[model samples]
Target: MLARASAATTALTDPGDRLAELCARIAGRIVFTTSFGIEDQAISHFIMSRDLGIEIVTLDTGRLFPSTYTVWDETEQKYGRRIRAATPEAAALSALVADIGINGFYHSKDARLACCHVRKVEPLARALGGAAAWITGLRADQSGERAAVALESWDEERALIKFAPLFDWTRAEVAAFCAAEGVPVNSLHAEGFLSIGCQPCTRAVAPGEPERAGRWWWEDQGSAECGLHVGPDGRLVRDQPE
Candidate 1:
């Protein structure tokens, strides 16, 4: 496990200090992005509990769930961390709408990806350009592609350190942490929302479905994305962008 971790990351190897130590060293200039989900809440809970100095930011895509927004505000007030929001670039969005037609993302694969690029990816790049490290709430159990990702990685496109504090945890363990700590989470998870994205792009998964089925359910094979995690240069980073 240690050898695998080292090969997978450029971060420090002290397993005992993997999450907290990294946050302490980097949090001053680092920022954690959240969607107010369980895994995200768990990491935020750790930061709040440890009194780490890091900015907590969220991308207000303007089309998020009411509960997601609610939790964002509530979590800020509860934890006393200022939750900064990055909004969509209006000019880019206008151009996207013009080129793709209104709601064109729903009509075809290209259209959906195009919409995601303008709305999520570009805005996130602007947000992270000045930060030294960006934190996320990813778990290996989330995807087979993510199974080998380490707790911290060198993000090539963003050219910064990327940390996933809960990368080693399982879904149940994450939920248990949230429950144990009494953290605020999105209410939609109880209804089988294994993975949640924009309201228009998300749905509740049924029995035996893949955890990510809630996102981009319409597309067939090779067509899953909402663009925030993809770099402007079109390479996929380890975690969801927003």
Candidate 2:
């Protein structure tokens, strides 16, 4: 089933057309998760403008920058539709917070991943429940670990097909599309923030660093991810790019 979907989109050159066709192929069971970053905003624009019927969902980590919320609000107004919100369960989040103070993630990688599990991954799992496919704004050039990203692959953890429509898209392409389409992007992007996540965990990247360098910046260079799109074996499944 997943192979058939990938094959259907293989020949498409345009991202908007690729996404529209994928949404139609999967119909009501597709979910697109956005974080209001440039890439996400571009995908959101395509989905809304085409009225593709794919549900747009966002995981509010509760630690996002104020600018991110500004983009989100503006996006809602522009599209005249609410993006579905998914969040961590209260009790679970409280327990994790209590065990390791709210800022404990700064102390260790384990603490950070635990925090991510509570604040991002758990909520995402709930958001993706019963969906046939999940979409993300991931790009191969973002980080070394993500260098081999596939436009389509099966997600073992989520038990569904994972689609990265922008896997082959460059940062320049994303910036151009957002600018041309008037997409509402996080204002922080102007400050050298190529990638945006929680305010506390992310920072502006140095000129020579990877796009994902800003995320989890304090950690070791290669350990920047939050485990959302990573497979159980710690690598993204690679397939031929569309």
Candidate 3:
């Protein structure tokens, strides 16, 4: 299945075409998780504008910026479709807050990882349950950690295929596409929040800063991930070459 799926996408240059073909070739549910970022908006457009059957969903960490929510609403209105939300489990969230004092993530890296595990990784597990394929907006140029991302890969950990349709796209190209396509994007993007996430965990980048520099800026450089794409050993889950 992995070899066939990889071969099917290897020849496709257009993201929309690749997605359409993936849906046709793969059975069971295909899920796309969006964060309302510029990259995500482009993928959302490719999937929704073409009326693809892929499921669109987001992780509402309950601490997102107001602008993020605004764009989320605007994107749905523009596409005339609802993006399902997978929020943190209530009991788990409450317990985390009680254990860490709400903003304790600011104190240590471990605390932040725990917060992410509860708010993002766990919710993503629920969102991806029974999914045959998972689609993400990961671009290789976003950060050094993601520089090796592939267009299609077999996610052994999740036991499903993972697709990064825009993996090779540059930030400028993505921005241009969103502009030409008139896709609704977060207003914060223009304000230097190139990589937006939760309000407390994110900030605007300075000149010459990396796109993801804004996220988890407090942590040491090159350690800004939230455990969403990495394995238990804290390394990216890369594809095994066929």
The numbered model that scores best in lDDT is: 3
Minimum summed lDDT over a 10-residue window in model 3 is located at 1-10
Backbone Cα, N, C clashes tallied per candidate: 1, 0, 0
CA shift of 8, model 3, Å: 4.4
C-alpha RMSD of candidate 2? 1.9
Error of 2 at 33 (Å): 0.3
lDDT measured at residue 12 in model 1 versus the true structure, 0 to 100: 47
Task: List the global CA lDDT of all models.
Answer: 0.72, 0.86, 0.90
Candidate 1 C-alpha lDDT tens digits along 21-89: 665455336778887888888778877767776677777777788988888887888987777888788
**For model 3, what is the C-alpha lDDT against the true structure?**
0.90
Which residue runs of candidate 1 sit more than 4 Å off their true CA positions? 1-17, 24-28, 221-223, 230-242
User: Could you give the candidate ranking by lDDT, starting with the highest?
Assistant: 3, 2, 1
Candidate 2 residue pairs in clash (backbone atoms < 3 Å):
none
Q: What CA root-mean-square deviation does each model show from the true structure?
A: 4.6, 1.9, 1.2
lDDT of 1 at 77: 86
